[model samples]
Structure formats: structure tokens, C-alpha cells
Target: MLHLRAVCPAERTEAALDVLRRHAGATHLVLLRGAAVEPPGDLVEADVAREATDEILAALCELGIDRDGGVTLEVIDTSLSDHADRAEEAAPGDGSDAIVWEELISRTGEESKPSWTFQAFLTIACLLAAVGIATDSPVTIVGAMVVGPEFGPLAAIAVGLVARRWDLVKRAAVALGIGFPVAMAVTAVFALAGAFTGLFDRAAVFGDQHQVDFIYDLSAYSLIVAMLAGAAGVLSLTSAKSAALVGVFISVTTVPAAGYAALASVLGEWDRAGKSLLQLLINLIGIVAAAALVLLIRRRGATDGVTTRPLSSG
Candidate 1:
């Protein structure tokens, strides 16, 4: 469900159009031939195309049309014929007006950065968990789970693995790595400050906190959950359906473990802190490893028609 438009020279228009038309998924294609004033040599008319499925889009990208003239490609989501008509009517008349994948991923990249907003969200989420534990409030604990910002790094790691961009991988790793310690330190300072101020009790913070301690006990289920969530995260990134990703974010314990570690430090429960830290590490490692594995397998499958390759980077 994507709408694509391209503006290329008249000479290459036929080949491009043929490429688009031969694909069965491309249903509506309108080719207008002309030249733009700024680029005098090239054709100015718009060639509009729409894909009903993502597979078709991938196929077209794999074709990789290399042309000298200016070309703009766009993808639009259409659920019905009426929507397609509306997309056609709304097509851009000029070179500036076009749909492109790079643009879509760029906007996504901007919103998904590890910025102060994410820091604030994680801080608040941890605070909520601390308060929830103190007040014995299950609702607040779940709210904390929902508010945590654990998905950003997970996603960055996944994207880096898929695109084979180590710089992105390192940035995401650094951001996530630093973010956890910062959050833990801040939580400790605040929790100790609260304890001294008689706002909360050390015992209340660390006493009999098994629910939060659940993070430390790693099992097969842990690996399974990480793999499932990581795969879903990548799928969410590539596909149009994004709502399910939020639930996946909340289900993972990366942020909560960091919060608990900080809270444990404030309470002087070093054992709890150590356990939580271990859990956090296990989950983070599990997620990164599983995500990398999944992407590798998927890429190999796409290229070789084999989905499960050996789990070695080499």
C-alpha cells in the first residue's frame, strides 16, 4: 500500500514504465512526459505508481533503476480504490513534490533519537516504579513499565545490524550503556535524599521486593522473550503497522531493571542492586545478540532462500 512517483527524462521513461508495469503489484500507473524549466534537458512529466504490497516494493527496489535523468519515487498506503483516487489527485505537480523511502526513514530516525525527552521519560518511569513499590501500588508499577524508554537503543541496535552500519551500532550501544548508569546514579541520589528527608524508608525501598527482583533470574523464557520482542521491533520498523511496538516496549524489563538497580543502591541493598544489574545485562545482551541473529538470518534468507543460517558473524 504505497504510492510512488518519478520524474525522469523522456528517453528513459519507457524502460522505467516497463519495469513498473511488469510488476503485478503495481496497479495504478500514470505516465506524463515533459521537461522541467530548471532542468532543461530532462523530461518534466510525472510518472505515478502505487504498490499494493510490501513484497512488490522490495522487488522494485531490488531492480535498482539506474538512470541519468532526474527521478523521484514515492510509496503511498491505499486500502481501497477511493484512497488510490485521492492519492492520484494529491500527486505533486513539481520536482519538489515526491514520495521516497529515505525521507520516511529519516523522519523516523529523528523521532527515535536518544534525546533528553527519552531521558526524562525513563527518569519519570523509574520514579513511578519507586513510588509504586513504596505505596504497594500495582497500577503505578505497570504505569512505570509503560513509561520506560528501553526501546530506543534496542531499535538502534537492530537497525545497525540490518544495515551493517557499525557507527550506528556503536552510538546506540553508547547511548544505552550510558543512559542506564546515569539513571541508576540519579535514582540512588534521589532515593537517598528522600530517605534522609523522611519521604520514604530504606526498608520500604528494598524489603521483600521480589516482583522487581524478577529481572535478575534469567531463564529460557528470558531468551525467548528477547528474541520475540527484538524480531517484532525490526518488523515494526520495516512495516507500516506500528501500534504493536508500544506493547513490546512495555513488556521488556531493560528500563525497569535499571530503575530497580538505582533504587536498590539508594536503599543500600547491594545484593539487590547486583542482581538487578545482572538481569539488566543479561537482557541487554540477549536482545542485542538475538536481534543481530534475526537480521542476519533474514538477510541470508532474502538472498539465498534459506532462513536459518549458522549463528556466526563470519
Candidate 2:
């Protein structure tokens, strides 16, 4: 279930209330007259099933409640009311299968920006992966993968393309195009410093580091794993099975490959660096393609009543 709260203008209150009252999955509706001080209107609240959230949001949007007034939705972890259960059951589809577009947009929108925090995490993950590569430590590599924050922008790109949100696509593209290069450059500088301090192992870069060779050895397997991971990642986001996202994190080698490329370049292993970059590109391409396909399928299969509009619609 989801908790929905909307402030509606005095003139539009009835329309918004009707939207909630007519929906089987929108229950426990409350309307407080002149309750909104800021917008100076009525306050409307309801418990909406996950399956019906998209429809309700779309309806409210069409009435311009989200613009003149305001609308907010939050997850309801538990609902003791039998009314809640009935609401969920009455909904056309299972909650887990629902795609709440507003939620997804809010979640990925900020991630599309190449914030300092995103750059920091990516650089840190790459540096950690570089250490793991030098020591041939699978455990450290896994940790680095979990720490990497590259998936957000990748997901944003997928969602943007499917939802026809070109601004999102542009922002995500800038994040990836700028963030990766910046991370790799920082990682390379750090690797150079480590080599000067005799902390980085040149032998690992030049010799047979078979344990970490998979990071650079791009193959059909890399593409397959990346696609699977990408699908699972988007599924996790849509279904609210966020824990599954961790598995997706460790399954792709984008960060590790970047780290490997950075260290190899600093070590003058140009061939190894080239191969690592190829591996990164392969994983990125596969992930974006798979994720876009999944979102496209979900959008196509959406219920007729459920429609998605950009947060800022034209």
C-alpha cells in the first residue's frame, strides 16, 4: 500500500475527491476543507494500493493538482485495516508488478546529475578495485563493486528513453560521459602516486594476474551477465525488492574494469588498459540495452487506466 496526500485548490477539490472516491483501490479517503495554508485549499489524503498508485497520480496530474497545489506519496509498510487488504485485492494487478512512474522519476532524477557525491563514490570504488586488482583479492573487488554508484545513471538513461523524457536522457548521458572519465582520471593519478611511493605492484599489471583477468577479458559472457544484471536491477527498482540490487551491483564489472584500466595505463600496460576499457564498454552497452527493453515492456503492458506523464509535462 501507499499513502497519498494531495492539496487541491478549492475549485478542483471536488474533482480530485471524485477521482479518489471512484477508484476501488483508493480507500480511507479524507478531505479536509481549507486545510492547506500555503496553497490555501483543501487537503486530500488516501491509502492507495501500489497497483493503483500510477493511475491515481495520473488522474491527479490531469486535474493539475500537482501544479497549483501539491501531491506527495510515500510507502506504507504495514496497514492493519481490512480496508487496506480489500483495496489491494480489488486492484487489477499485484502490487509487486506495478510501475509507479512518479516514484521512479523522483528516485532517478537526482541520480542523473553528476554530483560531487556520485563522482566521489565512483572514484573511491575504482581506487579500491585497483588495490584489489594489485592483490588479486576477489573479496576486495566485490566490496568495490558494491561501493560503486554507477548503476543510478545507467538506470536513469533506460527509464528516460522508455518514458520519452529527453531531459533525463541528456542529464544521464552527461553523468556517464563526464563521471566515468573523471573517475578514471582520478584513479589513474592515484595509481601513479602509488607507483611513485612503491605501494602499487607493477608486476600485477604486467604479469599474469589470472584472478582478476576477467575484468579485462571481455567475452560473450560479460555481455550476458551484464544484460541479466541490468534486467534484475530495473526489476528490483520497480518491484521495491531493493536488496536484489546488491546482487546486480556485484554481477557487472564496470567499476572494476575502470580500475583495471586506470592502473594498467599508469603501469604503461597499454594493451591491458585497452582491453579493460573494452570490457567496461561492453558491460555498459549491454546493461543500457537490457534495461531499456525491460522498461519498454512494462510500459507497453501497463493497464489502460495507468498512464505516465513527465513530472514537468509540456
Candidate 3:
């Protein structure tokens, strides 16, 4: 369920009330006239089923409430009232499966930005992966994968393509294009310094490190794993079940591959670097393809009025 609050202009209050009254998914409606100070409007509040949020928000936007006033949505973690349960039952679809496009888009937009924090995380993850490759440590590689922030922009790219938001697509592309190469370059320098100081063994990077070799080893399984992880990552984002995202992070080899490529380049292993780059490309393509497909299918389902169940029972 979601708690929706809208500051409606005096002239549009009736229209907003009608929308809530006519929707079966809305309950616990409250209206306070002349309650908004900033916008100098009436305050309207309602508890709405999650599945119906898209339609409600659209109607409010159509009424120009977003421009003239404000609309805020907050998840209702626990609703102890029977009215809330009845509202959910009255709604057309499952709350968990609901694709609240407004929420999703807003979230991805902020996350995909090329912020300093994003760069720091990406660079640190790459550095960790470089060390992991040099020492042939699977644990360090997994840690780097979990810390990598590359998935945000990647997911944003998929969402943008499905939503046909070229602006978002361009922003995400710039973030990834600049982020990956910068991270790789920084890690390369770090690896070179470590090797010179005798702290990192350049030979171990090319040795039979069975545990970490998969970072540069491209195969059918790499594609399969990336595809699955991409789908899971999208599902986690849409459903607000973020714990599943950690699993997605550890399952793909994107960060590891980038780290290995940097290490290989610093060690003058051009062939190994090429292979690692290929692995990186393979994972990126597979993940983007899978995530875009998932978003497109969900958007189509919503358009066709197909109700979807949540991935897990709350």
C-alpha cells in the first residue's frame, strides 16, 4: 500500500476528490481545505493500493497538480486497519507486482547520476579487484563485486530504453562510458605501483589461479549468469526488495573482469587483457539485453492490463 498526499489548488480540489471517490483502490481519504502554506492550496490525503498508484498519479498529473501543487508517495510498511486490506483486495492487481513507473524512474534517475560517490565506489571496487587478481584471491574478488556500483547506470540504461527516455539513456551512457575506463585506468596505475614495490606479484596474475581465472574466461555460462543477474536486479529494484540485489551483484563478473583487464595491461599481458575485455563486454551486453527485455515486458503487461503477482510474499 502507499500513502499519497497531494496539495490541490482550490479549483482542482473537487476533481481530485472525484478521482479518489471513483477509484476502488483508494480508501482512508482525508481533505483539509486551505491547508497548504507554500502552494496555498487544499491538502488531500489517501491510502491507495500499490497496484493502482500509477493510475492515480497519472490522473493527478493530468489535473496539473504536480505543476501547480505537489504529490508525494510513501510506502505503507504496515497498515493495521481493515480498510487497507479491503482496499488491496478491491484493487485490480497484486501490490508487489505493481510497476510504479514514477517511483522507479525517480529512483534510477538519482542513482545513475555521475556523482562523486558513484566514482569513488567504482574506483575502489576496481582497485580491490586488481589486488584480488594479483594475489589470486576469490574472496577479495567477491568483495570487489559486491562493492561495485556499475550496476546502477547499467540498470538505468535498460529502464531508459524501455521507457523511451532518451535523456536518461544518454546520462547513463555517459556515466558508464566515463566510469569504467576511469576506474580501469586508476587500478592499472595502482597495480603497476604495487608490482614495482614487490607488494603485488605480477606473475601470479598469469599463473594457474583456478579460483580467479573465471574473471577473464568468457564462456556460455558467463552470458547465462549475467542474464539471470540482470533480471533479478531489475526485479529487486521494481519490487523494493533490495536484499536480493546483493545476490545479483555477486553473481556477475563485470567488476572482476574490469579489474583483471587493468592488472593484465599493467603486466604487459596483451592477450590476457584482450580476453578480459571480451569477458567484460560479454557481461555488459548480456545484462543490458536481459534487463531491457524485462522492463519492456513489464511495461507491456501494464499497458495490456495484465496483473502480475509479487516475487515474494510479504
Candidate 4:
């Protein structure tokens, strides 16, 4: 369930309220007229079943209430009321299967932005993977996987492409575009330092690599696993099953590939470096393509089920 609040101008309050009132999935409606301060409007709040969120939000967006004022939504973590159950039952489809597009847009939009935190996490993850590569440790490689932050921008690109939100698309693209190379460069410096200090084995990279050669050795599994992980990642985000994301993170080889590639470059293993980069590209492409396709399918299915045009940009 979601608690949705819409601030509507006085002139548009009735229309907004009427939309909410007519929806069977929207209950606990409350309206405070002239309650908005900055934009000066009426405050209307409702408990919306997750299954009905896309429909309700699309209707509100059509009214330009989002443009004139705004819409805010938060998950109802504990709705103990019977009315909530009835609301969910009254809505089409199950909440778990429903797509709350606005929330997704908001989430991806924010996460897609490049930040110092994003850089630090990516750099650290790459560095960690480099260390794991240096020592031939699968456990450390897995740890690096869990620490990677590349998925945010990857999912952001999917949502941005699906929504045709160029601002979001560009932002996510820039994040990924700049993020990987910078991370690899940093990992290379770390590898160089390790070499100088006799802490890293430049030739261990050519050894067995603890059977982790899959990070650079491309095959069908590389694309297949990446695609599966990508789909799962997007589903985790859209359905609010975020706990599943860690598994998705561990399934892809992106960060490890970057780390290995960086180390390979420092050791002058041009062939290995190139192959690692190709592996990384495969993962990125597989993820973005699968993620975008899933979003497109779900969003389209929602629109068709409602017999409505695409949700408005507002």
C-alpha cells in the first residue's frame, strides 16, 4: 500500500478529489482546503493500494495537479485496517505485480546522479576486486561484487529510456560513462603501487585465477547470467523487493572485470585487458537491454490493462 498526497490548486481540487473518490482502490481520503503554504492549494491525501497506484497517478497527472502542485507517496509499512485489505482486493492485479511508475522514476532519477558517494563506492569495490585478483581469492571477489554500486546507473538508464525522460537518461548515461573508466584507472594505480611494493603478483593474473577467469573469459554464460541478473535487479526495484538485489549484485561480473582489467593493463597484458573490458561491456549491455525491455513490457501491460494512454510526463 502507499500513502499518496496531492496538493491541488483550489480551482483543481474538486477534479482531483473526484478522481480519488471514484477509484475503488483509494480509501481513507482526507482533504484540507487551503492547507498548502508555498504553492497555496488544497491538501488531499489518500491510502492507495499498490495495485492501483499507476492508475491513480496517471489520472492525477492528466489533471495537471502534479504540474501545478505536486504528488508525494510513501509505502504503508503497516496498514492494519480492514479497509486497506478491501482496497487492495478492489484493485486490479496484485500489489506485488503492480508497477508504481512514479516511484520508480523518482528512485532511479536520484540514484542515477553521479555523487561522491557513488564514486567512492565504485572505486572501493574495484580496488577490493583488484586485491582479490592479486591474491586469487574467490571470497574477496564475491565481497567486491556485494560492494559494487554500478547497478544504480544501469537501472537508471533503463527507467530513463523507458520513460523517455532525457534528463534522467543523460544523467545515468553520464554516470556510467564516467564511472567505469575512472574506477578502472584508480584500480590500475592501486595495482601499480602493489607491484612497486612486491605486494601484487603481476603474473598470478595468468595463473588459474581461482577459477574466476569467467570474469574475462567471455562465453554464453556471461551474457545469460548478466541478462538474468539484470531482469531480477529491475524487478527487485519495481516491486519493492529490494532485499533480492544483493543476489543480483553477486550474479554479475562487472566490478571484478574492471579490477582485473586494470591490473592486466598495469602488467602490460593487453590481450587480457581487452577481453576483460569486453566482458564488462557484455554485462553492461545485457543489463541495460534486459532492464529496459522489462520496464517497457510491464509499463505497457499496465497501460493496456487500464485502457488508458501512456501516463503523462507530469
Clashes of each: 10, 0, 0, 0
* lDDT for predicted candidate 1 compared with the true structure: 0.58
**What's the C-alpha lDDT at position 188 in model 2?**
92
lDDT of 4 by residue, 26-58 (tens): 999999999999788999999999988888888
Residue 85 accuracy (lDDT) in model 1: 52
Superposed on all Cα atoms, the candidates' RMSDs to the truth, in angstroms, are: 7.9, 2.0, 4.8, 2.9
Error of 1 at 70 (Å): 8.5
Index of the highest-TM-score prediction? 2
Tally clashing residue pairs in candidate 3.
0
Best by lDDT: 2
lDDT tens digits by residue: candidate 2, 93-183: 8898989987897788777678899999999999899989988898999999999999999999898888887778778888889988999
What are the lDDT scores of the predictions, listed in order? 0.58, 0.89, 0.87, 0.87
Worst 10 residues of 4 by lDDT: 304-313
- lDDT string for model 3 (42-114, tens) is 9999999999898888888889998899999999888998988898999887888989887877777678888
